[model samples]
Target: MDVRSSAVTIPAGNADLPADLLVPAEPVGVVLFAHGSGSSRHSPRNVAVAHALNEGGLGTVLVDLLTPDEDEVDSVTAELRFDIGLLAGRLAGIVDWLAAERPVGGAPIGLFGASTGAAAALVAAAQRPDLVHAVVSRGGRPDLAGAALGQVRAPTLLLVGDLDEEVIALNQQALGQLTAPAELRLIPGATHLFEEPGTLEQVAEAAAGWFHDHLHPQPARA
Candidate 1:
C-alpha cells in the first residue's frame, strides 16, 4: 500500500461499534464505506477499492452498519440487511465519532456504498449535508433511500452494470430524484457483481476521480 494504513476499532460515539479506519500519511480526504448488509469490512471488493483510494492519497473507513449480534439475526431474518434507516443511523454515528476523533487531521469526508448499503449512505449524507462532501455507489440500490433522495446536497455518482437491466433502471429513476448534482454510469458488459475482466478496476477509477474532484482537488498540472 502506498499509504501507511492500519486497522482501527473505533467505538462510535461511545457505542459498541467496531470500525476499520485507514488513514494515509497525507490524506486528500476520507471515504467512509457503507458496505452491503451481508458484507462487512472484510469484503474483498471494497478492500480493493479502498486500497486504490489510499494509493491516490485518500483515507478510508470500512465499517459494518450492523453489529455482530444484528448481523447474526439478519442472516436468518433478512430484515436488518435492508433496513436503510437503521443502517443510516449507524453510519451517522460513525461520522459523529470521526468528527471527534480527527485521526486524519479533519479532512473532508466522502461516502462509498454498495448494494443496499448505497441507500443508507445516501440517507446518511442527506441527514448530514454539511459533513459529507460527496457520494459514490457501486451496483447499488439507491432507490431504497426513498424521499431522502430529494434532500441530498452532496454530488452523487451511481454506477451500475450494463447487463443488470433492472438495477440500471432503478438507478436511472433514483438519479432523477436527486436535487443535487448526480450522474448514472454503466459499466459495460458487467453483471451485478461486476466480476467481469477489469470491471471492478473501472469502478475504482471512477470513484477515485469523483472523490478527488470533489473532496480532494489537485493543483493545476505543471
Candidate 2:
C-alpha cells in the first residue's frame, strides 16, 4: 500500500503536541499510539507495530503525550509519568483535533497504548465512547486505569507476555471490570519488552488483527 508520512503539530490548550502521522492509501482506520513511561513515539517496539499496521492499510499517528519540558521534569521528579488523568486528557485533545481535521477522511479511530499509556488510553476511550472504535494494550498496566475500565465501551484487547507475571495479574484484574468486549492473550516465553526473537512480531500481528476486527470488518479471505 502507498503511504505518506508527515510531521504534525496539534494544538492542546497552551501547548502544541508533535506527532508523526503515516496515512496509507485507501485506509480503513487510524490508530493513535499512546507511549509508555520513559518512552516516546520513537519506541522501536511501537514503531514496528505501527509499520505493520500501515502495511495492513491502516493509518497511524504516533504523538508525544508529554511536552519536552514536561518529560524533562518527569525525568527529574518522576511525577508525571503515572498521571493517568493528565495523559488521558492529552489523548482526548488529540482525538478532538483529529475529528475536526478529518485528515483521514472520517475513518474510524483506534488507540494503541503501551505500559502506563494503556491506562490513559482506556480512560480516553471511556471519555469518548462515541469516537473511539477499539483499544489495544501491550504489556500495559490496565489496573492503573481504575474506575474508567467499567466505562469503556470500545472493544479492548490486552496483550501480555508470559514472563511478565506482574503485569499479567494486573491485566486480569482490569479485565474483570471491562463490560465491553475484551480479550487477554499471553505471548509465551516473552518478557515485558518482547525483546526475544519473533516476540515483537507476535505483538504486531495481534495488534493489527484486533484493530482490523474492531475498527473495520475482517478482510475477505482469498
Question: In order, what is each prediction's RMSD in angstroms?
Answer: 3.7, 3.9
- lDDT per residue for candidate 2 within 1-222, as digits (tens), equals 789999999876567999999999988899999999998989998999999999999999999888999999999988898999999999988888887898887778999999999999999999999889899999999899999999999999999999999999999999999999999999988999999999999999999899888896333336
Per the 3 Å backbone cut-off, how many clashing residue pairs does candidate 2 have?
0
How displaced is residue 169 in candidate 2, in Å? 0.5
Of candidate 1, the 10-residue stretch with the lowest lDDT total is 213-222
Q: Which parts of model 1 have CA positions greater than 4 angstroms off? A: 216-222
Against the true structure, whose lDDT is highest? 2
lDDT for model 2:
0.92
lDDT of each: 0.88, 0.92
